[model samples]
Target: MDLNWYWYIGLGVLGGGVVGWVINAAVQKARKSSAEVLINKMREEASKEAEHIQREAKVTAKSEILKLREECEHELKERRREQQNVEKRLSQREEALERKNDSLDGKLKNLERQEKEIELLRERLNNRENELQQSISKQIDELERVAQLDRETARQMLLEKLKNEVKNESGLLVRDLLEEAKQKAEKESRRILTYAIQRYASDCTYERTTATIPLPNDEMKGRIIGREGRNIRALEAATGVNILIDDTPEAVVISCFDPVRKEVARQLMERLIGDGRIHPTRIEELAKKIAKEVEDDVYSAGESAVLETGIQGVSPQVIKLLGRLKFRYSFSQNVLQHSLETAYFMGIIAAELGLDEQKAKRIGLFHDIGKAVDHEVEGSHAQIGADILRKHNEAKDVIQAVAAHHGEVEPVSLYDVLINACDTLSASRPGARSETTELYLKRLEQLESIAHDFAGVESCFALQAGREVRVVVTPEKISEGEAQMLAKDICQRIEKEMNYPGQIKVTIIRETRSVEYAK
Candidate 1:
């Protein structure tokens, strides 16, 4: 039993020991596992702290690098600005130097020109000095050789000698030249005038003042007188002509101051007498019809005149105006006939003189065209005719010729002078125009009055039927030259103022004879 108890206790104690050991081992293992877990957690915390520090350092480095790059860029910009400023300063210095160089070049050019001028002035001064020295030397030599004459005496002697020589030679030369010129002029003038006159032998017809009209019967006059002379009165009033219906068998006398009006009245009376309707109303109507017919006749006559003259391209209006010259008269000469004759003569002379025959014929034909309407128009017929020709677009030379035919305008062409010469020859031909008794006496009075107007004339006489005018001049008051001039002046004045058919030969009789006979 005892052995069993001991054994049981030993067994129990050993079991207890084993249990304590197992319990101790389990507690120790648990402590070790908890310690290991704490260590691993601390290691992980340390590694995390190191990683965070590394990240902070890397960020700081990147920040520092960026700051350094920025600072470098700022430095580079500053360096570039300094380089630009240096370049600008250098450019300014270069410009200043260039300006200085240009100024120096201008100054050098001026200096060079001044030097050349100084050299030229020096040369000129030297030349002038040499000329003055030579002149002075010559003057000294002259003074030493001869004595000076008085200025007035020397000049007077020279003048007297020159004057004597000039007077002798010049007087003879002038006299010879004057005599030769006079002879030549006389010969040439005679030739020209003779040729002009010989070439143009125009027919001159005397203008008759009386117009004749044949009546139908003697009883027609009683009808013309009408019941109370109303027909005659109407005829006179319409035509400005007096009806002379007495002592005539088969004719009626028409008298008027105007020849045109007289012819119109004469024609009107004839028409009324032939119609046998001699009343005041019929007279007025016939008068108007006859007036128109006469006007038409005048136009036709003018056209015929122009056609006869071989002048074409004349306007109808100009022809009508020219026809009016048929009834017009100048110095007892029919103006239209005279113009035609003058045109014929002018054409002949123009052919002889180697001129334009058509132009000459036209100018001569229209020369007196204005005379037809001169009473109604102003100015001379030549000037008026020129206006008409110009309006018709005539040649410039023709217009000039027409205007200068009467010497009223300055002759611009040779044709103008030729026209005047031809006109003069046609009018001044012998027996061309007749002078009336009243006109003859008036011309004689005019001659006497013109002669009296002269300074040396004592008396004047118009002889040869006013063809010659003799002026008796006082010998004591007039010299030969003065007498010649007086005669020319009288002739010119008579030509200008008087309407004569032929030229008047002016004779100045200056008598200086003394009647002292020794027996």
Candidate 2:
């Protein structure tokens, strides 16, 4: 039994084992299948994940391409807009250039037309000038033919005829006018001068620079010529004069250039002869006394002139100068007397001419006052007189008359004219002044010579102390009218060539003689 049991158990055990193995194998196989299924599932899952990742990548790439295309389109549109703006500006500039060129072409055409018109005007003007010149030339030729003479010959003939006519008519007219003027002036001048001369009658006294003193006797000469001529020398030295004690009959001559000094010496000698004192000291004293007396005499003469002329305003110094004129001499006439005569004549003329007589008298008195000091002063007596008057406060009219009387200054008033006329009339009076025989003959010869210098003059003679010239002309050479003209021409020529005191008459003589002797 045990055995059987053991075997069965063993077999049971083996069977169990075998069954367990088989189940084990089946379980392994099931596990293997599960592992493989898991692996496959995992692979499949991985593959599916990879495919989804690939699709996502493709979608992202497509979106990026679309975005790039859109950006390129926007950039191209901006570039096209910029190109259009550039083309529009270029077209506008071309149109403006074309318009300017058209306007310039029209202006150039107008300027060319104006230039052509100016050229035409110039040509027309030139043609007109040529036509005018030809017309003027034809007119000149016609005039020359009608005159039947050349232009120069016709002009000379007309001038000659006109000259003759003008000379005759003008000569007649001038003669009539001169005759009328001479009639009026001569009547008035003669009346005035005649009345003036009749009013004033002045005495004529000739003044000499030397004096003759009559001595009581000739023996007084030896006393005058003290021992060795000391007395005569002292007298001359004291008096500035020469004392001549000659062998004449009771006479002594005192010589000096100054009339005043000569008078003083004469008086001194006379007094010395009377006093019988002949020394140098006594001679000097007497000279001084005589000089003082001469000075008193000069002042007294000046006072006398002032009183005579009735001019009350002259200074004492001027009066003294006037008194000095009493001893002065001019052309052999006493200056004081000449001045008095001039003053008297001036007064008379002034009365006739309705001028101031007193003023005229004053002018005449002072006119030659310069002659008193002329030896000491230089220059003309008229100018010196005027200066002295000015220093002494004389009137302007008086000074001017004095100065103009000599023509040293221009005369500005009627006083100057009247004074000059009076001076001339006074100086030119007959016997007022004398000339030598030689001068008178020479003047007459000069008059005849002047008349002989003219043409057609046959002979000439000076008559009436050369106051008239008679000219004889050839009758065949000079007509009556020409003779009259010749006389006038000779008169004018004489006036120009000669200087005379008065007017000279010219007489022209023409004659035709019909003389036949029966033989």
RMSD in Å for all candidates: 21.2, 28.3
Which runs in model 2 stand beyond 4 Å of their true positions? 1-171, 203-225, 243-253, 273-276, 442-519
**Residue-level lDDT tens digits of model 1 in 396-450:** 9988988888878898877988888778777777756776688779978887787
lDDT of each: 0.81, 0.85
Candidate 1 weakest ten by summed lDDT: 143-152
Evaluate residue 428 in candidate 2 and report its C-alpha lDDT on the 0 to 100 scale.
65
TM-score of each: 0.56, 0.61
Best by lDDT: 2
User: Candidate 2 lDDT, tens digit per residue, 412-433?
Assistant: 9999987777777776677566
Name the lDDT value of residue 199 in candidate 1. Answer: 64
Residue 311 in candidate 1, Cα distance off native in Å? 1.9
